[model samples]
Target: MNVLSENNSITETAILVNPNLGHPRFLEIDQKLKKKKFQTCLLFISDKRDPAYIRDYLNDRIKIVPILDYKWQSQLLLERERKEKKGFLTKVKHFFKRKKKQISELLSQKKIEKTQRRLESLKSRVYRGSPIFPSILEVRSVLTHSIHDLEYINNEYCIPQDYLIKNHAFETLDVFYEIKIEFTLADELLDLFRIRNFIMFDIVQEKNGITERINYHSLVVSKNNWHDFTFVQATDLHLAQRNDRIYGIIKEWMDTFKIENLELIEEAYKKDQKTKKREEQAELFKLPLKRRFVNPNNQFRIFIKLMNRKVFRNELEFVVLSGDLIDFTLLSKLPKDIKKYVDFDYDFSNWKIFKKIVLNFPQKKRRGVIKGEELLCPIFTILGNHDYRPYHYDIRWAGLYRKLGLKLEEALAVNDKLLALPISAIVKSKRALRAYWSQVNPLNDFSIKLGNNNFIFLNTGSDSFKNFLDLITGHPSLTGLTTKQIIYLQNLASHKIQQKKENSFLFLHGPPINPKGKRSFLKRLSKKISGKIITKLDEFKESVIKKIGIKKDTRIDGKFNVKTGTVSTNWSSLIEFCKNYCNLTLAGHTHSLKEFRLDDPKGLKTRVFNAPPFSLKKVENPAAVYYDVYSEIYTSAKDIEKAGPFVVQTPALGLGGYRNPDLAGAYREIVIKEDKLDSFKVKFIDR
Candidate 1:
């Protein structure tokens, strides 16, 4: 019989009849359910133990129902007799099995160590001559307390040092701030030495592999020390390449769902038709749709004029477009012309439209965007989730290379270049932007020095796989830095600090922390459970293979493995770096204008500035959407009658959701004084 009734969909009742499962296990289940905020009646079916035995374990929050079964008591008696007869033999078998398992575990540990050693050797060669880090000794000295050569693990790899520092730097920085000597010479020389105050230092390597430090403050000009520079940050542009493209995307989506939800699709189409009517009536003012795609020129014209006005005119340094530089993908919506899809093809028509939209910004002769006096500053950009070709396509996908009429590698190359071309061209055209991207890790990673300050720009979109996973999980700033990349950043900052830059600033598409907490509790919980299940299944498979005597060597993959790798999207590393090394970080994926000052254990604080989307139209708000598929998958009419929809609601997007009345379109002006953070002010542009 089922423990819980098949008709009980809401999990309103739980009956625990197995006494052998133990009180701890019984109470564990109770607590787990309660943590999920489930309301249920718990009943214990046992004659050996009274209901009072579990009463203390559960409180007023859970309802207790008692049912004593005499048949269960007879079953227990039979089980005890069976155990008495076979317990010794079972114990003997388990003893040998346990011994074998222990030996297997030791061999697995050895394999893991051997793999790590090989990977470390490869990294040492790849990361040799790190410009920012002169030597591993320097990084280790700064990151960890003094340790002997024998005590050092993976001394050749700087990754271990990064982990040590990332884990404890915030707490250590807090201590300095608590003592009120955080900025003093001792504290400055120790904690802030490489991250901040070191910009004046020059490293001179001696013949014995020791590095001598030299300060170059005298060689630097006084005028260059001028700290006042302002830059604007706007994120999540979601620029639609063309007005027609939007209609096409929606139409395709409606077509896909027409058979199942015709009414819903029809309603959405009608809404689109109504919007078109409204757009015609409001010709005097730009429609939101027009502003987003059809005529962004006028919208951008208004914004440029505002920025060029008397109050803001002279203060602007440059503009940073955080992400979502485009709308739609290469295989946006599969073409409906084909009955049976044999191959995937680039939606060239959509690409052409997108190209036109991007060209409008760069073509000097284009009419709308460059209408008034153009702002001469360069605009630096990073890709958002939408910028890439579709990572997940329907099963009908036959692969883009076959459909695009190109070799697999050629198709991939074309996609890569096409996705990045517009931003690349824009960056190349501006002298400032060109110089910025040219420095250190020339691809999507860049570092620039403006006077005494260092700025780092990361391509969060490059880690497409991790980023895609993050989106499905609703994690903010899911793009993670690679261990090699983190070390490069460390070296970059080290050099900048040695050059006497006041502080380093990081620019990226996603905020390090989710502005809103992980949106769906159920999704997160399910992900956790699924991850555990996958891990166990992998282990089980490995064990079965070993039992069959099929041995395989353990290997370390190139990608950063969150379980065994150095860097992750944990934000603790970013926070620790900012708290100890860098000054302020600017991000904008959430499309909300907000400032965050994270506090350490002490009074020390690290600042994060979040920018609102530059585009007038709203993107899909992740938090506002309600998804019940996870809960629904486990419940059906037979499983839980009258369970409603088994819906799971996420936290609503506060100011960032589409069509929110309060979203007046905003940007932030960051003021830097003496290379240190001065203030970040949000400037709202009301349409």
Candidate 2:
């Protein structure tokens, strides 16, 4: 029987496969629901096993129906497999193959300097071992090995060696049958599902393994069946301890670090040495750096107000905070003298402050109603450099060189803290976000399904730096996605694109790819020269001091101080991933708002959007800021929309006094239709 409507005729019946046990209602559905064969869409909603495992298990029962695997594990494993296939040899072949014609053309031109340079480039591409690539290869190798191991163990150990399998013939049971299912969706079904009808169902069973019944829910329409999908993006809140002793201490140190205020710094340092003078030291932390100081309470209110806005409160489904939720970088250990003044028990005051900020955000507000809903939308966040930077100890050059160790466990703790606090709040604040972080990795990378689209969040800060130099001040701090993360995302993208034909977005705290042709040559050159000089000087000092058997007080390492969002290197894998999988990539570390369109040789156009700081006072790269960005950007949407695939840099949300004597504060309202980008506009807010 077909339920006919004017727009869509529900001729095809979707089969909700129960892989665990055959539902008693399955017979009823097959006997009564429709007249034709049960061969359209197969949907499996299982929390116990993965979609792949379920689909593979139920393939025989559901025979001809196309399956949609919503399982996160299957997606990640598939990505890992694809990445492993591209071994070193494959990469080398592809590289040479791609550049073969170019190299031939250059050789024919007979331009010695240019041709020689091209040959050298090819050599480096083949031989130059990047800190990023090997790690990725290792992860791929491990994952591939693990998959193989699992199959081997199940077949060799369980089948022949295990007595249970040999005696009972459990492997031959119908439940263990390998079912055939189409990995790709049929064109007609794809067109039908594109209308955004998600049929949710569950399988129930008795303890004895007898099928009970199948429970089905109404089809979830896409955003009330609206054509326009609206979302708000904010980043880099950098909330820190305010009206506290720690704030004062850090502020005094930050203010005097670069200037000729050594005397005052010395006075404060000595005063902080005395336990009794702690309050006086705290008083010294008083500075007029408004941009850096954001009270969590105030920011929370601002978030509420922003969400309360008619534009957002009405239809805003999700909030994406790219990264840098806090500004406090963890100090490893205080100097001996300073430690004497600080109470050891009070070390976690900063974290306590952050906890309050995150945990207290979801409380029932005094304000009656926010827009039309009492609850805000779901907010998803990734870790920025600042989020975990504080958890790492401040290593003096001598200390760093002596031990080339990674704080793997300690780093995990910090990452957990960062994600857990927000997640806790999300759970408690039931009205706001409806999603859960069930599939998030230890590094806080995960893929979430919303409506018909997939949103993948990456922890770009993880495995970002190879050496201690990257942790140092003024060293190019901008980083790329980890190898494992890249592969996972690539696989997910491929799966969704091939099977579902859905739009996929990648979110990270750091910009994996910078805008094409957006760098200032002279500025870049000057920064490189200065950075090299500083590094060399630090190296010399460490060597000289080590030779003399001196343990110096290198506590004030220059690495502690830095402006965020400076790109030092281009990660080829990230660029390639964008070229392949990402329909839209959003990042927000630079604190500067800008956009660019990536032109790939494969004709894949990925639009990149860099979010502005949610609360940073000054942007890292001031040149990107405009005196009249507000007016200039008023028509950017239409202009950029016309320029094909594009990238957009948004403004910050709080406090701005930069070079141009203009306030930089803005949020973006992005509109997405199906998988293609519809249009976007920067909504500037007064700080």
Candidate 3:
């Protein structure tokens, strides 16, 4: 039959139906429609089996006007019976030959007829809505834990970042808090017998970066010890050069040979340890430090001793060295004379090589970071590109520290909760703000913990940082992120806050570019676009060029680069972290001296602090942050905002002592203010 119909577009339309088809198909069709949340009338064919209860009422629900001859259906049914009743091989032959040919012909004609019929039916169509789905959803396996030793998951596309969110109806699927893991200790190398704690990273992945796992390393405070805990966190103190900076570096050992030079350094650093003890000693006879005291040899020695001492002692908890502990970046870009240096192998063993590099490393200039094994307290090191050759480009040594002799360092220093991750569990705490590339997977992440208070470190940065931050803080801060990354933050905002039972702290490399005046220029000069459409804007067309955050020649504090416009603009994710944690986010990347708070209407609540750089030089936020484990508390988001640039600025722990000391003395000594913890009186001990 031909039916003429008005169409929305200039396209051909057709509808075909096979009257001879199985009648039961009609019932299946009705059910399918209902599953789509749609309602349909039952058009019962008289010859089909109708339920006994409904049989008597068949003529009641749907209106039936007339009856039709079975001419078309009779032929279809006769063929179907012939195919089914044939002998085994005869049946197979008939199915593929005559039977197949007939079905194909009928289906082709039916499609065309149905389209035309529906088009014609449009005249009588009722505005019925919705569709139904099959009652059952397909079975999908839960995420099977993978073992680490088995190489990396190469199928980048195989891992999905987000699953279609289960609607109100629930089904089984693997639901887990995806986290990253960093292991720098070995079983053979158990370094214990000291004070240390763990630092954790709470990373979240965004929709775009879902295939690219988010690294959320949370401080694993024992549920039991959430109330009573102590740990150490680190940043901006570049520990030293990696394997490349040092001549002999392999999968294991860092020094040419273990030496007493390590001891001398330790003895000198103890001066800070004995600061209180020295108060009682004579003013003149003490030592070389005291007045602008600078002890390069002794100072370097102390840090090395700690590294070595940590080799055998694992008692201390977490360890985080944010950055700039050493300057081993080639001393100079010039190539070294392998022949000349090789003349004297010194037969230096791996450990010896590691020690020599550590002992001889230049701390005065270079910046690095060491985050592994806790000593005296948990340490979380928030490092920048300078800290470790910016992996912003490659992931060759993604787990540098973990593969070294720090297995024990990882096992003992980090709390049991995190270390307990499956051997296959590896997370990348690194989030690249640029669109160029990223190796951030679920396997790489950084962590450090302290008493009650926990400091999680994020090694999030990018090579073209300005653009990276643009993508991030144009939504940026201690970390550089992309647009999809912004969504991840939004999601994490919901989770990180919930995880906090007590006080928590943030250890990062960048300052919080909170939506303050920073975004002013972006808002004024350039055209305004909703955060939703920012990603698709034409502003992100240039390379090394930022899209927004520029107004009337005044560049906002940050800029957006590749794929920048699309990033979501909000730090609401950490709003909860700020509200739930007595968090002190210490950073030094911007090299700018600044601090602020974003809180609720109440004044006394969550505490947020930013560490001013040591020098507006290479590394910013130079002060050593000391958290008073006992007292820090959280208030409302408004309270966090009200909290002014509370007491901040402390000297750096350097060669002789902290250089460029803050106007205020050390925040507080840990040992002395042990009882003042409840009052939020934090103290920094020299030792």
Top candidate, metric TM-score = 2
lDDT per residue (tens digit) for residues 643-662 in model 2: 33333445444322231113
Candidates in descending TM-score order: 2, 1, 3
Runs with alpha carbons beyond 4 Å of true place in candidate 1: 1-226, 243-301, 308-312, 328-375, 390-442, 462-470, 473-477, 498-501, 518-571, 602-664, 673-676
What are the C-alpha RMSDs, in order, of all predicted structures? 32.9, 24.6, 30.2
For candidate 3, the C-alpha RMSD (Å) to the true structure equals 30.2
With candidate 3 superimposed using the best TM-score fit, by how many Å does residue 413's alpha carbon deviate from the native? 41
List lDDT for all candidates, in order. Answer: 0.32, 0.35, 0.27
lDDT of 3 at 355: 27
Clashes per candidate, residues 3 or more apart or on different chains: 13, 15, 161
TM-score of each: 0.37, 0.41, 0.33
How displaced is residue 587 in candidate 3, in Å? 2.8
After TM-score superposition, the amount by which residue 371's alpha carbon in candidate 2 deviates from its true location, in angstroms, is 19
Local accuracy of candidate 3 as per-residue lDDT tens digits, 400-456: 222222222222322221122222112221221110011111211222233334334
Model 2 worst lDDT run, 10 consecutive residues? 133-142
